[model samples]
Target: MTMVNLSFVLFLLCGVLINVQIARSDECITGSIRKLYEELNCIPEHDETNGCITSYNCSFTNDQRADKCYYQGREFSDGDRLEHNDFRSKCIPTCSCLVRDGRAEFNCAHYDCAEFFQPPLKKNCMRTYSHDSCCAVGVYCKKENEEETAATCEYGGKVYTEGATFFPNEEPCKKCICKPGFSGSLESPWCEEVFCEIEIHHAESIRDNCAPVYFGDNSCCPINFHCAHASSDETQETEVESTTITQKANDNTPTCKFGNSTVEIGRKVRGPEECTECSCKVPPLIECVVNSECQEGKLKTAN
Candidate 1:
């Protein structure tokens, strides 16, 4: 062969060998690291000739600088120990990471008596319902009840079990159905709350002042509102009785009179007195309805 041709052939052979080596090197990633990369969506650019990954392209952030894998700006790596920055309770402790069943796992230390009983420097110690020791700064302990007997009525700070029903107060709507327990304990006694139906004699006057008129049965009439006539009333030319009204609160927006307080749209007004809850809603039509805890098992209707 000629010298020029021989040189060209040798050069081609060297290039082919180099490409093969690159391809081999690119496939040399560790199995665990490959899986980690895949999970992070890190597609490494492979060098065909050396078979080595040139770039991981894993998302990195300040917090994950030491991690081999990163995703969504968070860094993670196997066999890492970390502590929760927010929670410092005895039940939760420092955690360690591990690879389990091809997925990342965190093993946290279990709660211990020493940690649970540790006293707070400036807080009182209280026993939890479970009898565990806890700081009492924000804890609400159950009130101690000396009289364990169940009773049908509670009057003058004394419990009585003589009747099947009792009136807790003079309010016509406030009463309790006596349901004596076998153990005769006052814990969660059964009581049926009644909400009386209220009617405003002069609803028009309330509408004139832009004030919501409340009705018993948890409904309220807003100012400047009108109710649609019934199908039967529509066909007749007789006078249509106004069934709806509209009123406004401070903002001139629609308001609902729930019990004694007036509630505006998107605002919460609680009462009749403390035990009741209510809110005013708009959209689909503006209306006020009773949303009280005493409303359970009762028909819910909007006024």
Candidate 2:
């Protein structure tokens, strides 16, 4: 073969090889690229300027597929649910993960106060004005009633007229009655010592026979109070039970139930009498060391 003819054949071979390479890499590469974007289309097309031809991948990556959400160091996907106490909310307790715009988001439903005021969780139901976002924010049953009046308790976005009662799940250890307020008005729920009694039958006899316990998550009533059986291991079990109760009292939540409400360790509560102050040095135990309460006349004078 002649030298020129061989050179022409070599050039043709080079052109074919170049075309094959271009065809193989015509599509865009994944991850960050430095090519200038012009005709950014999903379909592959040839570009004379730069090889940055294919449209950028507009899909989710492998690590984050199936739509998930991370919140407070927790991962939640579609249909996953969170308890009411799982995360603090000023309104509702339970939160659900829902798909919104193809992403997971936390959604909380409106709580109903009247619905929870049943036999098991609570009885003698009275609406909670504190520690309950549903009652504080929405108030009653989360619906506008045409018959709602000014003398009604707002809860769960609805209205509870006078004499209507609800058992707030936030602080289920308190007892409430559907009766009128202490001063003969519904302005404020009676909030004095022994003001309300949770329907728990924890009498002196029951206390000796069985240990006081809580069955439900926040239910104050314990019909059985059955944490252990009666046997010769009573003393050892009692000591162990006392330790457990002490541990529970110090377990990052409320430890002791007072006349009106529950208190935590190191917390200040009411003292021996009115206008007196005390501290919860131990779980369910109060120590009155600080006595700086001004007399009623002094308070009136200051006012």
Error of model 1, residue 199, in angstroms = 54
State the TM-score for model 1: 0.18
**Total clashing residue pairs per candidate?**
23, 16
- Give stretches of model 1 more than 4 Å off: 1-73, 86-91, 113-303
**Model 2 bad stretches (over 4 Å):** 1-150, 173-187, 190-201, 204-209, 232-303
> Where is the poorest 10-residue window by lDDT in model 1?
195-204
lDDT of 1 at 263: 42
**Top of the candidates by TM-score:** 2
C-alpha RMSD for every candidate: 31.1, 29.7
At residue 230, candidate 2 shows an lDDT of 34
Candidate 1, overall lDDT? 0.36
User: What TM-score does candidate 2 reach?
Assistant: 0.24
lDDT of candidate 2 over 209-257, digit per residue (tens) = 2323323223333323322223433221112223221223224443433
Per-model lDDT: 0.36, 0.38
